[model samples]
Target: MSEPAVTQHPYYHPQPGTAWEHVDTAGSLLAGPTPLVTLANWQEEPHHVWSFQHMRELMPSQVIDGTDEPRPLPEAPSDLSALEVPVAWAPTVEELLDRTQTDAFLVLHRGAIIDERYVGRMGRRRRHLVMSVTKSIVACVAASLAGDRLLDPDAPVEAYVPELARCGYAGARVRTVLDMRSGVTFRETYLDPDSEVRVMERSMGWAPRNHGDPLGMYPYILTTTAGRPHDGVFDYRSIETDALGWIVERAAGRRMSELISERVWKPIGAFHDAEITADPLGVAIHDGGLSATLRDLGRFGLMLHDHGDVAGRQVLPHWWISDAAAPPVDVREAFAASVNEPVLPGGWYRNQFWFVPGDNGPILLCLGIHGQMVFVEWSTGLVGVKLSTWPLPQDGDKLVATINAFRAIGRTLAREGG
Candidate 1:
């Protein structure tokens, strides 16, 4: 099928504004020509990246899923000097630390906290935007409903969201949407004025500079026209996650934010409350817009590494974990081919999480735009969280190298402890 047509817009450049109110060193640290960050076929936008630590107030979100009781955290390691992994590609972490702007980093192994670090105005108390990592969290909520028979992956999506009957989602099955195989006619160009993604931004109030008529995201999503036949091929569409979120709301009879808090956050004993940004209409941006402290994100990764068991109680169904970690049936190879970009090779997308199929055992990762990650290697019992506000977007190579180095370091630690 042909790709959607691109739209042209007047190129924009960032103008110095009132310095970010939250960051103390905003003027001294963030001052400069905001670099243009481009992704895939997307055009570059003149953007001044904001530090993760100061993103909480910029976007608003509701707490959807969490547990009431705080899950007990394993003791933190006293020293992390023994863990070392040489970087095979890109600069080493130490070198990157010197050159790359970073916010927070945390590592866990065997359910124990091993290493934690913060940099450049980042602290344990601050919340950072997780961007697309929100997709994985939303996927978990959908999986929970499916586990309870509230949702059927094989069924048509219109069963839950009939409003999408006319858009690109028409005739698509829930599984296809979950796998991102929908035949939706949408463009993801970030800088294009006419792209549907840009339209989504305008609708969601993210494109503040655009004076065009308001095009709310949910309404635009419902209007997406079907392009290719359903299940014809795998296409990475963020709108699919949004659609899933809508379905989740329909089946659970609650908002995505609240559902996440009840089912995953509170039960797993999240260290802090996480928030998801909503549209002008108060609909949560499930594909992105999630924010939380680094420790809380690390704890969630630990829960996945433990096979959905927290404190010896099954918070999420074990089968749900297994299913979520497994690769998609039709799109594994296509997804894997993009791993060299920085994250993984031969990786699979399942339930919105990235799965690496290898002899080393499957590694499940939650990824976000602008370099947010929660990597969980089940075989080695390692979990790593990285949050960053890189000057530009679309640097998968750096992310991949960092994760590989992390895996290497994790192995060394396991051997020493063994």
Candidate 2:
């Protein structure tokens, strides 16, 4: 008989000094009594009890292996050892490692899983939350819809979701939302009690405890208001993704979960079922609720690496891939200027993906808060996935170093192959 799985003592808690908080609302809703999950309890081998293969029921994802089985990965160099990257920012990667505390890491290049490691309680199958990486998934859904002609990137948000007409989405175009140029006044401070993110937590059942509050996710989204005009400055707001989800649902005549399954998940041959949390009303939380295993995340990255085509089928229009990967005209300079960090310079965001404009080659990435990334370098056929439960509000220095390391590795492999 198998022994029951147990949780190890967490070394990283969302709130450092708080007690072990637990929320109860049927299950683990985001709001309510349980404090936001932190990475504290992670320990060593005693924690190997948790893995991704056993946690499939907790989230949404579709597993894809072989023409149905696991495909052979490309051969990798014998030793990666540990590469050190100098820090020229506020915090070094080592410093952030001490502060936020990271749990696991995996990197793949040219179809091969090159580097993989675990720390504390993290293991091969443990499903950690992807946070805002969900936004990029939603973006992919939107792009797929555009490819099918069900959506027009230039169309107004009102074209699909009429309810957003009076909200901050009033005059926003689909393109603006994709670029996060929607002038929404969403307060994103994770620690602020009155921030919109907190309110969202309450709405999604993620807040610590808030009884007598509306129980579903959609109502919270419906109530969001517009703060500024569309297409101005770059503001990262989860609400825009929520609005985009609504648009996708309205146009497709199905739930976002089902749409993703049919359009992306199933087609890509994912290795597990990815789950998206919902409000009591059952509307999918498109902003940041999706979760999946690291390997499956790599598969999704591979799908993009193949140019939105899998098995020779043009799953997504080539033009859609081209556009989403293209650098946005308006924000290129601003984004480039913002990349003052040593490792990443001249980075930009387009179609909910991050773009490294002037690196070894053009790089596009799907990044989530707290160290979740699906980085793709098309020029070299490289795709890397890193999933972590690092203490939130990210350590920019560590992220830059890791990205630089991946880029460096990709260049080395490409040159060797040549």
Candidate 3:
């Protein structure tokens, strides 16, 4: 199966070296010798390159432990550097990775690794922050619990977390929150100091809190108010996922990290224990905060591509994967009316996964701020994970280019009988 052909875009020069390769000579580009990374500056420029891979050092975190016997991702090592992507700025796979500040890149086709690269300060053992990609991973828990009748998707958010009865989540169903269609009025503006996202950061202890601000994630969420009616157009709010985390915890009578460990990490036979940043009050930050190694994330993407299969053991619910892969027809209409439609035409958001129209079918995208992506092309049996620190929260061009690069690679490998 061939992918849609791409016109060669004008080539652009990539930076000289990996993100951390350039040292100022005065000292380290970020901090001298041993960089002084703190919660306040960890997400900032130069500091982020190091802090993203070392988040546990700056904050309280809970581990999602992997299994003693890990799943083998045998290597086939194909040269994919010359593969041309569709975007104008970075024409080839190598340049696209460098230009976009990729920390780690891996491609798995039919469950075997075809290509893998680790940039400066990145290694097989180093865990990198995946930002909003964490939402999709955490959602697995909600779906699994629901499959077991431990959770009720049609139930209102307040039913699980009664404390939210007076908040913006009032009357919002669990299904609505999973799809990010809740009427929550929180703004997602990352750079705005006064935006709800940044304020939520303070609550999660990822940023310095202002005086009189909510002390924890739950407290802050309790203050939000509804901006519109429930089941409206997709809003892409991170807090909705956080609320889902809370709901799952309340439903299963377990912590989010524990749930992920039991339901995902171990079943997938991940190589290392993944961790999520915790608030001062010890609640896992489900909106983001997950830092995991590259290969472990690849294993996760592979599991999705295989439709919940983990070495022949069914780990995720079949119904959940089916629903996410081919969502209801109305999902596309909901996404079309959203601001994201311009970037992802003919795409939809369901079961916490993003789907974009593809040559063969819809491509499942688990995206996060700052270039984190896990692209699963089920038709071609391809799964690719790219972890990056783009120095900005979002870049539409980089995001699109990365997707194209992965698609091109998948098409090539499929034709080659990979």
Candidate 4:
């Protein structure tokens, strides 16, 4: 097999004289008087430098409000600029930011902020796209419901969303959907504009669409059909999360925006409100499309690190968080034999969260396209978040390096008493 990406050359940037050289990320101006951000493709190139953080401006969305009395994170910001993280073949932490196109990143140890920084016009107040990290956040809410017997993991999807009675998800259990073993025809290809991902994006108003197209999240979801049998094998399906989101809403008799605000953001003490992109029909895109400030994202990670507790309150159920952190045994084996196998050696997906098994306790992760990550290392009580706008949608090398960087940071924190 070819060398693992984490063990490859460190610098993955384009050549010195390429057109992307010295591109302006502030106004997203590519050339003189020519802004790259257009309705046709605001998510493309230099445009995303702005769009990634200002998604609420480009699309219809609903606010997931935060609390007025936002609980404060203890700050002891250490200058990690010189902290030499020992990734297999990665650059220094400071250099990695530039090499990876990170917009903002934070490192927390034991619920206190140790290091945080911003680049490319990103700051503490602005909410940046956490992309599919939204899936994990929504998953936590779903698990909360399950903890309270409001939803049953073994219950069929049809039990929660009876409208799906005729769909592929009809007989699929909520547990199967959570584990991504619900065999579906959906394929997420970000490079192909004609792909299903783009179809969903257009339906959600991320890209331009025909004036009278079938324009709703539900319509797009109902169109999907199963391709193969689900035999306890893991498949990374983005639409599965959307289906689970529907189930959660039906079970709670509330919209995702309301439930997430009441259960997650408000109780967790997020500093600012988060937003989710919604279809023109006002249905929130629960699979992806969450945007929040970096620090707030870190706060969620810290909570997960503590197994869903903050201060003395059980913001999320400890048992539920523990269950998510440790998936079914068969599912874990299936995950190791699947796509995410390469991402994390022995990783499993449960309720949209990633559980990476190791000698240390599981590393709970929330990963997103274009390099958004919330890594909660329970073994060391460390948490980290990195939000980026990579030029390409998928880069295996960058992802491997990111995992390594987090590991290095975790090791340093554990050893030096962060």
Candidate 5:
């Protein structure tokens, strides 16, 4: 049976006397006074509000099918909107959501839904574009394959996909790619038109292709060159995840969509069949092309919070989660040397997940451009997912505020023992 139609939830109501307000997405969609969302403008504001939820209509996608009987999200709803979060910009959590262009937000504490809200056209069933959150999810699949002995992180990437030997990934190990430590020169500057990220997006069919651009992600991968030796300082490159995705597929003798469906989505009991945008050649855009519902993402976060345990079944490898949360000392040293250190003080990157030191414990983060995040508080057993359509790809203020909000919420729940 089809899911029920989505209606504007009461939780999205603007808090009277505050600047908070819902994003008006009712009219002027693809056709109207507003500019139409095309391959070129879909990532832009105004258009992204609608395009984020309707990506399948704009591009070719592969369905990561879910189970018919979804896992239940036990509801114990609370009014967290009024909760005071320590942030310089927003006075309350509700205002933070609005200020960040949040489409959907959900919080899970000990496997129970504590708060859930939708804004504009977003609802329980809508699958919003998750951008680079896809990287963390793809890493989960890679970890699972490793646990099954189907893939080896120590193995060179070219062992699985020999074609990569001629590219920048010539001598990079699968583990190197997972931690974004590959020596490949990939400028991830989102705003720069001539950045390597934009160029790769064009090859992947995400942007309008220009003359002389590579045909697809594969050809583009070959064009990249090694900037330095492998196993160097941490570099925030999206293409590393793409190479990691290819390695897992080759090791498992399957496609990324199938690997994700069998290894992560279904195992988590996702309610909706998630969609992944594909290139013109039908290659999955593993770096940042996933679209999934809010609740499903919360479920994925919960699994990580519970140390990869779903009830009695162990879905993700326990070792993988532990290593990611608390990596070796070198990982921290490497992260501290990177450009991200100033933004994330005393943090590290491992296995595609971002880790920030918290007062209680290490916090695990799966972040995407434009305010997409899955926040997991390890010690507090709090998991939260925020899906947003921020006008700009990166906003330091918004990102810090969101992280603080989740941290505050986790602390509150831990104190209450609820």
Candidate 6:
């Protein structure tokens, strides 16, 4: 397992019968400056635990500025430590953090923060990479643009990015890519280093350097091949978000950082500036390269909770939020026939958010690799964001456990006066 096993990565596999309570990462760290943590090995366990928070040191990033006059968090702080969460081993709330490799966790009720904690090396002010959670934010912006008639989802990708006419995205619609229903033959298996997705990662500077095939973000998208028909199957391809990012740039005539800062962070009153990694050609890696403070993420969640209103201002369109949260019947049905995962049981993936319907209502979630997540229960106005650095890309049991923990948190907050 030390030599990059095909199915297993190094460090922190939970020992048998203990869940993740007994997992240790002391043996896997390359801590000193002698062994620098480059982008190539940055996603590994111990390295990722640090690199995820500090991507600016390895790659060029653009700032998503926030307002100087920050919107104060509603005064409703509670002891997250006492809020015990259920787990297979014990009822300790810490178990959820330890098992999931959580660096920061925040829970909000009715737009007021109920509980917040920073674990491991996480500090109050430091920004942590939200990974694919960035996709949801990007989706919100894209939907907002479509609402304003600045962009058309039904239009072909080539309409905005005419350069894609010869690429696999020639026939793909903006909405299809947003919903991840594009019939582009791009595999996203993170476990295999040689996979097509990894190739994309290498091009984006997330993986090891290969001087031979150093494709930029645009060129990589152009290399994609046509696959099955666009059948609304809810296929998840990270590159689709990048394509959407480009489409948005073309439609809005502005960079992603500028749009997000102007639209989201400033209006939401984020205290700290967010950042997103960019390729060498200055293309923002919108798929999974956003980093932001935990409080700002909660603020963004509050905006969604209130149907896109932030600090008395409508930062996003209400119709867009509701519609994206509630995907069409055909799209929802497609999810039933698509890939099955523990956390995504019969849920719809529309415009970068996952719709997991419950009896009370639907719980929209945005999950990223290595356990970054934003879980929102719109019915109860409960939102939870967890940033972590789990060693592996996917873990079925961990995914189940994460959703269960979110449910437990929601239920607990509902009964008490949080």
lDDT of candidate 2 over 192-272, digit per residue (tens) = 656777677666655432544455555666666776677876666777788888888898898888888778777777756
Report the C-alpha lDDT of model 1 over 215-288, residue by residue, as the tens digit.
Answer: 56778787778776877655567888988888889988998788898777787788677877788788888888
Error of 2 at 415 (Å): 2.7
TM per model?
A: 0.83, 0.79, 0.91, 0.89, 0.92, 0.90
lDDT of each prediction vs. the true structure? Answer: 0.69, 0.65, 0.86, 0.79, 0.88, 0.79
RMSD list, candidates in order: 7.4, 6.7, 8.6, 7.4, 8.5, 6.5
Tens digit per residue, CA lDDT, model 4, 1-418: 5421211112222235644333334334334434544445456666678888878777788999998888788887777775576554556788777789999999998888999999968999999998889998898888778768899988888888878867666668888888788767777877665667677666666665644445887777777777777546788878888888999999999999999998888878998999998888888889888899998999888888877888888877888877777655887888877876876787788778887764487888898988889988877777999999987777878877777778777787788884
User: Judged by lDDT relative to the true structure, which candidate is superior, 3 or 6?
Assistant: 3
Which lDDT tens digits does candidate 3 get at residues 1-418? 4522322111111135523223233233453444444554567676788888988998999999999999999988898999887867888898999999999999998889999999997999989999999999999888778878998888888888999898988989999999999888988988777789888888879876766779999899999999899888988889989999999999999999999999988999998999999998999999898999999999999888888888789888888988887887777778889999998878899989999878888899999998999999977889999999997788888888898899988888898894
* Residue-by-residue lDDT tens digits, candidate 5, 220-321: 989999989988799999999988988888999999999899999999889899999999999999999999999999989988887788877888899999
lDDT of 6 at 100: 78
By TM-score rank, best first, the candidates go 5, 3, 6, 4, 1, 2
In model 5, where is the ten-residue run with the lowest total lDDT?
3-12
Predicted candidate 6 versus true structure: per-residue lDDT over 1-418, tens digit per residue: 2433222234223335542222223323554532345554577766777788888998999999988998888858877664566677536566767767889999888778888889877888999999899999998788778768898988998899999888788888998888888888988888776677888877876654465556678788888877788755777789889889999999999999998898778888899999999987888899998999999998888887888887677778888778877667888877787775335776888778887766488888888988888888866668888888887877767766777777777787777755
What are the clash counts of all predictions, listed in order?
Answer: 30, 47, 0, 0, 0, 0
Off by over 4 Å in 4: 1-33, 210-213
Report lDDT (Cα) of residue 78, candidate 2.
39
Best by lDDT: 5
Q: Using alpha carbons, what is the TM-score of model 3?
A: 0.91
Q: After superposition, how far is residue 283 of candidate 4 from its true place, in Å?
A: 0.4
* Ten contiguous residues minimizing lDDT sum, candidate 1: 36-45
